[model samples]
Target chain A: SQELEQSPQSLIVQEGKNLTINCTSSKTLYGLYWYKQKYGEGLIFLMMLQKGGEEKSHEKITAKLDEKKQQSSLHITASQPSHAGIYLCGADPYGQNFVFGPGTRLSVLP
Target chain B: DTAVSQTPKYLVTQMGNDKSIKCEQNLGHDTMYWYKQDSKKFLKIMFSYNNKELIINETVPNRFSPKSPDKAHLNLHINSLELGDSAVYFCASSLGPSNQPQHFGDGTRLSIL
Candidate 1:
């Protein structure tokens, strides 16, 4: 069975501050994806990482994959109110279907 | 245009009733998937179909059936809906079953009473 665990189940940050969310998988990740979703809304894909030590950034968010430890991290730089949402990390252990983590809820206080 | 869309954004029904959620993708993707988001926001893959063929069914309950009419459409039918079935169901599609970024629909919220 594959499992994904996320750190800091929920986070609160002031505007302009930075925060990082982590996703650790029980199995090696063939691919890792990062997505964001507003409450009750559909998820929007942010980035995808496949190789170990790979990193990708979009706008204000950055994601990295550490294949050795089966870990991935999503970092937001200079957070804003618009960045407040649920950050989810998904891992593809078998290169087929994704198993998403429990998600990290982020709240940006202005 | 919505790349992936699911009909009936919200559904409310009594237990023991049957319901279905329809999904379509205009992106011409060859793969479609069904995912369930539980109350704690844990997203789990229920099914994945590629080119109208079932690719993955993650040990989901028999009551949950996924049908693919074509490469662009996948529908989920739930039988004997139970209160525990209340959750958000998301429909998504990708160019392939693996190593592809998926497009997601707004999701269908199912509530069983």
Candidate 2:
């Protein structure tokens, strides 16, 4: 079975500051997904990285998959209150199911 | 329009009772999944159906059953629920079982008293 570990179980940062959250998997990942969930809402897909060394960005958020495909990081620039939520990383190891990490709670204070 | 939707955003019921949660997706996806988020915010896959066929059934107990009458709808029924069964259940859908990013519903918050 594959398991995922996320660094900085929770974080508090000032708005307009930059922060990064890391996700590491016990096994090589076939696909890595980044999602953000508001306090009581569903998850909103952010981005997906498939190949090793792949990096993608949307607006002010960027996600990168390491060359080893065992670790991924999500970086947010100029964070806003809207970015405050639970950030979760999910990994697909066997393409059969997804294993999610214990989410990193982000609090951006204005 | 909502891509994925679940009925009864919140559910509160007594233990030992049976309850059903309904999900529907209009994304024209072939695969649908049910996930449970615990108090720790750890999301776990409970069941997955591809094209109305059961594809993945995790270590979930037999008391939890998932039914997919069509590719766009998946319903979950829990029998004799316990206190530990209380959690936020989310429904998701994708183009296929793997490689595609899943779209999640607003989730149903189930509370067992």
lDDT of 2 by residue, A1-110 (tens): 89999999999999999999999999999999999999999999999999999999999999999999999999999999989999999987785578789999999999
Off by over 4 Å in 1: A67-69
Where is the poorest 10-residue window by lDDT in model 1 chain B? B94-103
Cα error, residue A66 of model 2, in Å, equals 0.4
TM-scores for chain A over all candidates:
0.95, 0.97
Give per-residue CA lDDT, model 1, range B1-113, as digits (tens): 88899999999999999999999999999999999999988888999999999999988889999999889899999999999999999999999888898889999999999
Per-residue lDDT tens digits of candidate 2, residues B1-113? 99999998999999999999999999999999999999988999999999999999999999999999989899999999999999999999999889889999999999999
Q: Which residue pairs in candidate 1 collide? A: none
Error of 2 at B82 (Å): 0.9
lDDT of each: 0.92, 0.95
| TM-score for the B chain of model 2 | 0.99
